[model samples]
Target chain A: MPYVTVKMLEGRTEEQKRDLCEKVTKAVSETTGAPEENVVVFIEEMSKNHYAVAGKRFSDQ
Target chain B: MPYVTVKMLEGRTEEQKRDLCEKVTKAVSETTGAPEENVVVFIEEMSKNHYAVAGKRFSDQ
Candidate 1:
């Protein structure tokens, strides 16, 4: 089973998230040959302060 | 780049999580040859209701 996770900022619409889950599940299943149901996708949302790049947080930018 | 994630219950202490991040980073770096700093470790906490096995959720058990 291939478990996919998409981590990004916490500002997506519910419909966008629903579409993402469906499309991501399909893509993962197609590429990894895992069944659609067996492929679990978790969406993790992080706050800007908790996320950083190059030692500077997104909230600071 | 190598990214390590430890997905489990949400009851570990801060000390335990700190140790986990350090050890996991080392392990991933050694095995994947990625720098320790580049080896990002994200700790994901899942609720019992959100996780299930064999159609039975942990909260129900």
Candidate 2:
């Protein structure tokens, strides 16, 4: 089973997330050859203060 | 690029998360030989209401 997760900033509409889940599931299934039903997609939203890159928090930028 | 994600219920302290990241990174490196610095560990905390198993939400249980 190929479990895919998309982590990004919060505030996306429900419809956007639904589309993302569908598109990402298809992509993963196509590339990995996992069945569409077995490929689980998780969406994780993070606040700016909780996300950091290169030792710099996004909220600080 | 071996990226490991530890998804669990929220409310873990910062210290706990830091330790989890370190340990998980070490495990991934030992198993996959991805360098410690190159192995990224992401801690995703989800609320009970947001998590579901077998089509049943944790909050519902």
Best by TM-score: 1
Which residue pairs collide in model 2, if any?
none
**lDDT by residue for model 2 (A4-61), tens:** 8788889999999999999999999899888999989889887754543332335555
Docking class for candidate 2 = incorrect
C-alpha local distance difference test of each model: 0.74, 0.74
Superposed model 2: Cα runs more than 4 Å off: A1-61
Q: What share of the true interface contacts does candidate 1 keep?
A: 0.00
* Segments of candidate 1 deviating more than 4 angstroms: A1-43, A47-61
Note the DockQ of each predicted structure: 0.09, 0.11
Give lDDT tens digits, candidate 1, residues A1-61: 6888899889999999999999999999898888998988899897654443322345555
What's the lDDT for candidate 2? Answer: 0.74
